[model samples]
Target: MRAEFFIKSFCRIENGQVMFNGNTIFTTESEIFSNFSKETYRHFEISYPKFFKMDNLSKLAFLAAEIILKNENLDADKNNIALVFSNRASSLDTDRKHQKSIENSGSIFPSPAVFVYTLPNICLGEISIRHRLYSENSFFIFEKFNAEHLQLYAHNLLRTKKAEKVLCGWVEFDGDDYKAFLYLVEKNAEIPHTVQKIESLYYNE
Candidate 1:
C-alpha cells in the first residue's frame, strides 16, 4: 500500500510574530534576530542555554522546530522521523559574520563557536540533538520557496520507509529578513500533504 501523508501542524515566524495553526503565539516590534529571537525564546519559556550561542539561522530554525514539536512524543521511534529543510540564503547571514570576525583587525581569530554553525545543516543537527532524533535529514538551497521539491522529497522519504514522519519547511535568515514556515507531516491526517496545499499554506501566510 502506498503511504499517505498529512500535515500534523504548521508554524510561521515572520512579520514580528510566530503564528501556529493560524493563531499568533508571539509578537514583537523588533524583527531582527538579536531582539526578536530572544523575546520569542523567553515567551516560549525555553530553558536551553545554548540558544544564546547559536547563530541567527540556527536560532530561527530551532525556535520554529520547538514550537511544532513541543507536544510531540519525540522519544517514541525517534529515528523514524526526518527533518527536511530548505533556505534561499543558505548560511550567508552567519557566513558574513564569520568573515567579518576573521577580517577584523582587532580580532583576527575565527571563533569556533561561530564557525560551527556556518553550515545550514547545523540547524538540523541542533533539532536532532534536542529530540534525540537519529533519522534522515537534509538541507537544500533554492532560489525561492519550492514546494514541489519539498513535497516530492518528503513524500518519497515516507513512501520508501526512510521515515514515518517528516518535519519540513523553509527557514531563511539573511540580515534583518527572516522567515520560518515549518510543518510536521505524518501518515493519515486531516491535512493531506500536497504540493498545492503546501504552497498555499506557505504563501498565504
Candidate 2:
C-alpha cells in the first residue's frame, strides 16, 4: 500500500521560548545557550545529564526532539522510525568552538568533548541513543530552509516503507541565534505532509 504521511506533532524553539503545537510551554529570559538550554531542560524536567555536556548545536536539537517525542509511546522495535534533519549552519557553531579551544590556548589543547560534536550528524546520534532508535538517519545542509527537499525526502521514505514514521525538520544553532522546527511525521494524521504546510509551520512566526 502506498503510504500517506501526516504530521503527528510539531515543536519550535526560538526567541528563548519553546512551543509545542502552537502553545508556548517554556520560556527564558536568557539567550545564551548555556543558560537558556539549562533552564529549558530544567523546565521540562529532563534527566539527561549528558545534555549539559553537549555543544550548542546538539543541545538545541536535543531539547527540540525531547518536546516533539514527549508524549510518544514507542515499542522496543522502533527501528521503523527515521530521523531526517537539515540545517544551514551544519556544524559551524561547534567547529568554531573546537577551533577556538586550540587556537586561543597557549598549550594548543583541543577538548575531545567539543571536538566530538563537530559533525552535524552527532545530534542525530544523541537523539537516537536517548530514544534507542536504530533506524535510518540523514543530515543535510542547505543555504536556507528547503521545505520542498525535506517534504519530498520524508514522503519518499514513508512511501517506500523505508520508515514507518519520520522525525524531520530544521535545527540550526550559530552563535547566540538559534532556532529549531521539528515535526513528527507518521502514516496518518490531521496535518498532511505537504511542502506548503511544512513551510507554513516552519515560517509561522
Candidate 3:
C-alpha cells in the first residue's frame, strides 16, 4: 500500500474566538474576541480588507478554509488539490436577494450570475476557484451532515487516489450566527476512522 500522508495536526476556533497558537484574531460574530487590541485589529484589517465586505456565509466559508490551510502547513502553490465543502444553509442569503428580484421587482429580472450561487455546493466551487484548485470537487448537503457518510466518501477518495489531500467540513450561516469547522484529512493510518471521534471535533458549544 502507498504511504498516505497523516493528518499531522489540526486547529479549532479556540474558546469561541478566532484564535490560533493562543493569539486572538479579530472576530466580530462570536463576541469571544470582542476585546481584541487595536494592533491586532489593524493587522486583520490590512490583510483582509475584502473579507469584511463578504456576506456572512462567504465570510464563514473563507475563514474556515483559511484555518484549515494554515493548520495543514502545506504548500498551496499548485492547483492540483481538491476542496469538498458541505454546508446547511446553501447560500440562503444569496438566494434571498436574487429571489426578491424575481418575486418582487419586475424590472430587474434575476441575473444568472446571482442564480448560480444558490446551489449549496457553489461555495465549494467559490473556494476552489479562489485558490486555483481544479481537482476533484463536490458539494453536498444532507438534512444534517452525516458523519458516517462523510467518512465513507473521504475514505473512498483516498483509496481511489483521487486527491492528494481534501478539505472538507460543515459551514452554516443562519442570520448573525455562523459555525464553521473544517478538517484536512488525507490517507493515513494515524487518523481515527470512527464517526464519533470525527464528529466530536465539530460544534464544541
Candidate 4:
C-alpha cells in the first residue's frame, strides 16, 4: 500500500500539558472533582444528571469528540468516520445496579431504565447517534488500559478499508477519574497503507 496521508496535524497530552500544534489549550486543577454532583461523583466524580443516565457516556464522548473535531476543523457528518473504544470497567456501575434490582428478591423487576446501561457498547451507540456517524463502531473491555488494543483495532479498520477515517481511544468514568482521549485518523497524503505496528508504538520500553 501507499502512504496516503502524513500527519500534517497532531495533538497530545504530555508533561502535564495538553499540547496541540505546539500550543497549550486548556488545563484544570486536579481538584476539579470537588464541584461535581453526588451521583456524578459516585459514578464519575460528581458528573451531571446525578443518577445513571444511559446517555451520559454519549454526552461525554460527544463533547470530547467535538472538541477534537472542532480543533481539527473536521466535519463529522461529511467524513466516513468510525469510533472504536476500549475501557477497563465496562458498565460496571450499571451492572451493579441491575444485579441489585434482581437481588432485592422482593422486587423481581429490574428497572428497564437502569438495565439499559449495563451493556458495554451502548456508549458507542449514544455517540454515533449524537454525531450522526452511522459508520463502523466497536467497544472492547480489558483488565486495564491497553493502548495496544486501541491502536490495533484502529489500524485494522483503516487497513481493511472498513472506514476511511476513525476516532479511537480510551474513555472510562468511575468514581473520580473521567479520562478520555481520542484521535481522528483519515486517509490522506502522508500516511500510507502498511503494517501498523501498535506494539512498538504503545509498548516500547
Off by over 4 Å in 1: 1-3, 76-79, 105-109
Model 1: which ten-residue window has the lowest total lDDT?
A: 71-80
Q: Using TM-score as the measure, what is the rank order of every candidate, best first?
A: 2, 1, 3, 4
Best by TM-score: 2
Across residues 1-205, which tens digit of lDDT does each residue of candidate 2 receive? 4336789999999998999999999888896778999899998899999888888888999999999887887776665789999999899988998898888774455688888999999999999988888888999999999989988898888889888889999999998889999999988788888888899999984
Model 4: per-residue Cα lDDT over 87-195, one tens digit each: 7877775677677888885565658877777786887776666556777998888787676666567678878988877777666655445555555666664533222
For model 1, how does the per-residue alpha-carbon lDDT over 1-205 read when each residue is reduced to its tens digit? 4437899899999878999987888899994568999999999999999889888899999999999998785665555789999999999998998898888735655688888888999999998887788889999999999999989999899889998889999999998899999999988778888888899899863
Worst 10 residues of 2 by lDDT: 103-112
Model 4 worst lDDT window (10 residues): 196-205
Candidate 3 Cα outliers beyond 4 Å, as residue runs: 1-6, 9-16, 19-54, 71-79, 108-113, 188-193
Looking at candidate 3, the ten consecutive residues that score lowest on lDDT are 32-41
What is the alpha-carbon lDDT of model 2 when measured against the actual structure? 0.89
Q: Quote the positional error of residue 157 for candidate 1 in Å.
A: 0.9
Tell me each candidate's TM-score: 0.94, 0.94, 0.72, 0.65
| Candidate 3: pairs in clash | none
lDDT of 1: 0.89
Error of 3 at 104 (Å): 4.5
